[model samples]
Target: MGKGPGLYSDIGKKARDLLYKDYQADHKFTVTTYTSNGVAITSTGIKKGELLLADVSTELKNNNITTNVKVDTKSTVSCRTI
Candidate 1:
């Protein structure tokens, strides 16, 4: 199976929701980490049909780490309209 895509940030969330309304353009993604219950939290937002990293690359790119990864996580229902 293929991995997923995401936009990552060290601090602060992407103020604007991520979504690509145009089919002609490549889809993009955004990722952020937040504090929750005294733990660090990471979230990813992706547009439809956008491909993130593949399963094979996840280990190599992330130093052999592959847990909590998203394979096909897309934006919430709100973004589906556009």
Candidate 2:
């Protein structure tokens, strides 16, 4: 009952290692979009595990809202508003 014998203390650390520890990871993902106002957005990612997003094309590209997002992958996200 007291600290649960330290079993949960290392859960976070173990989870981090299990998710981050990688050797020669391979993954590919791409996202492309064209705004109604002639704006274009493109993103590509290549890393470990299967790609969740790839070659995505969207029609309506105007995101001007505040929100919270979380991603658990080794990739790059570049956002440029026009």
Candidate 3:
């Protein structure tokens, strides 16, 4: 296949879509914010909840693509004031 104007763009879009789908199924929560830097997602329920922060960075050059994805999860803690 020959490189075209939208080659990298297409790849990027597909990657994003797939990531979103997997994140939703895994977390059962919607992404609050999405940007070139990263995404923030959270879930809350009666039993327990969690917050997920992911940093996504991509670089494309010379017909090569590099993607970095880092995820951080924080658990919710219940605290009582004494």
Query: Relative to the true structure, how large is the alpha-carbon lDDT of every model?
Result: 0.36, 0.50, 0.41
Give the Cα error of residue 56 in candidate 1, in Å.
20
In the range 1-82, model 2's lDDT, one tens digit per residue, is 4654557667688788878887455666666655568555555566545445433222234466322222334443333333
| TM-score of model 3 (CA atoms) | 0.20
Clashes of each: 6, 2, 0
Best-matching candidate per TM-score: 2
What's the C-alpha lDDT at position 29 in model 1? 48
Inter-residue clash pairs, candidate 1:
3-54, 3-55, 4-52, 4-53, 5-52, 7-31
Q: What are the root-mean-square deviations of the candidates from the true structure over C-alphas?
A: 21.9, 11.8, 20.0
- Give a tens-digit lDDT track for model 3, residues 1-82: 9975866567688778877855534443333444454433333222223544433222222224333333334433332222
Candidate 1 lDDT over residue span 28-73, tens digit each: 5455454432323344444447455321111112344323433433
Candidate 3 clashing pairs? none
The local lDDT score (0 to 100) that residue 26 gets in candidate 2 is 69
